[model samples]
Target chain A: AQSVTQPDARVTVSEGASLQLRCKYSYSGTPYLFWYVQYPRQGLQLLLKYYSGDPVVQGVNGFEAEFSKSNSSFHLRKASVHWSDSAVYFCVLSAQGTGSKLSFGKGAKLTVSP
Target chain B: GPKVLQIPSHQIIDMGQMVTLNCDPVSNHLYFYWYKQILGQQMEFLVNFYNGKVMEKSKLFKDQFSVERPDGSYFTLKIQPTALEDSAVYFCASSPWDWGDTQYFGPGTRLLVL
Candidate 1:
């Protein structure tokens, strides 16, 4: 069974500061990785995705994630976050031959303090 | 950008009752999925359906649970004889195709079974 681990439960960063959310997955083979963000009282939105190709993938709102096969990780990074970036970010994994069912991590709540 | 809409933002029912959650997936999407998320917990996959058939289901999808897309109108998850443990947010998602495709999620229906 593939599972995602997001060690950070909550993070508080000042506006305009750089941010990184660490994500690690337990899977023998490479799987589809994704980052989704959910604002209060809203549906989840895709931030970015990584499958095969270059390790780095760009997403909406200055968000990006790098797939590290050797590290078994795909960490989301933002050069500079705005107040609007405050939300619950989820790290998701979708393994092959599993009907594309997503396995989500306990989302990390990010607070961009002014 | 695509959107998946879920009917009934919130639902409250007594144990042993029946509840149906409706999801209007993206028009061109072919795969529909249901996920359960408890308060402060990670989202867990419940089931996935395509071609009017269930492709996969997790253990959380108990025997009391069922899914169907009648006439290709709305994808529905029906829980008969709901238990207190069923109190959680149910999210509906859809993807144009399976494997590596972005899944658009609905706002989720908060179900509370007393």
Candidate 2:
């Protein structure tokens, strides 16, 4: 069984500051990792995905995540954040043969202060 | 960009009543999925459907819960004898193919059982 762990439950960053949301997964083979963001009362939106290409994958809204097989981590990072970026972010992982079933982490709430 | 849509953005029902959540996937997508997210918790995979059959399901998919894509028009999840525990956001997602392509999600249906 595959599982994901998001270490931080909540993170606060000021506008224009760099931000990082940590994510780690436990899977037997190469994992398909994804980052999703959810504004309040809205559905989850795909931020970025990491498969078997470059270690660093860029996503919408200037977000990016780097996959590290050695660390079993795919952490999302942003050079700067805005108040509009405040939302709940989730780290997800899927195994090679799982089809469309993604194992998601207990999301991290990001609060961007103006 | 392709988008999925859900009906009855919010539904409130009695504890013992039945509830059906509907989803309309992208026009050409072949795989459909259902996921649940309780308040302040991680999103959990429920079931995955393809070619008129369920491809995979998680432990969270109880016998009381069922999924169908009748007529290939809408993918639906039905919960019978709904309990308070079943009150959560039910999300429907679809992907073009099964190989880890981006799965677009609908603006989930929030169910409240009282």
Candidate 3:
């Protein structure tokens, strides 16, 4: 059973502050990892994805994530968060040969206070 | 930029009523998927369709739930005789291919079954 775990259910940060959202996954093999952001009343937008090669992947809006094989984790980070960055972030896992069925984590709601 | 679109942003229906959620996937996408997310919960994979057949379905996909993409038209998820537990935001996604391809998601359809 492939699954993703987002430890932080909610996070509050001041504008211009750095942000890090933790995500861990349980999968027997190397899985495709993705970070998706859902804005209020909007569809999910892919932030980034990691399948292999580079551990650190860049995403839209200056967001990035590092895939740690040893930790079984893919953590999203931003050097500075703007108010527009306030959204729900989801860590998703998709195993190979499974038709790309995604397993999502309980999203972390980010609130960037100005 | 390619994007997916969903019809009926929100729907309120009584239990035992039937509901059909429509998804207009990307123009060239070949794989379509459905996911369900209950309030404050992680999104769960419902089913994946390719080549006019279901490729995979998670355990959460009940017997009453069905998916089809008739005539290369909108990918649809139909739930017959819905139950209270069936209430959730249903998301539609599509990918060009299956091997770690990026899946573009549509704005979810929020379903409330009373």
**Residue-level lDDT tens digits of model 3 in B1-114:** 578999999999999999999999999999999999998888988999999999988899999999999999999999998999999999999999985888899989999999
Which is the better candidate, 1 or 3, if ranked by DockQ? 1
In candidate 2, what are the lDDT values of residues A12-31, reduced to their tens digit? 99999999999999998998
Model 2, span B1-114: residue lDDT tens: 678999989999999999999999998999999999898888898999999999998888998899999988889999998999999999999998886788888989999999
Residue A68 lDDT in candidate 2: 95
Docking class of 3: high
Q: Model 3 chain A — which ten-residue stretch has the worst lDDT?
A: A94-103
| TM-score against native, each model | 0.98, 0.96, 0.97
Q: Estimate, for each residue in B14-41, the C-alpha lDDT of model 1 and write its tens digit.
A: 9999999999999999999999999988
Question: Which residue pairs overlap in candidate 3's backbone?
Answer: none
Tens-digit lDDT track of model 1 for A58-113: 99989999999999999999999999999999999999877689999999999999
- Report interface Cα RMSD per prediction: 0.7, 1.2, 1.0
For model 2 chain B, give the 10-residue run with minimal summed lDDT.
B96-105
Pairs in clash, predicted candidate 2: none
Docking class for candidate 1 = high
What residue runs in model 2 are displaced by over 4 Å at the alpha carbon?
none
Considering lDDT, which of the candidate structures 1 and 2 is the better prediction for this target? 1
Query: What C-alpha lDDT, on a 0 to 100 scale, does residue B82 get in candidate 2?
Result: 94
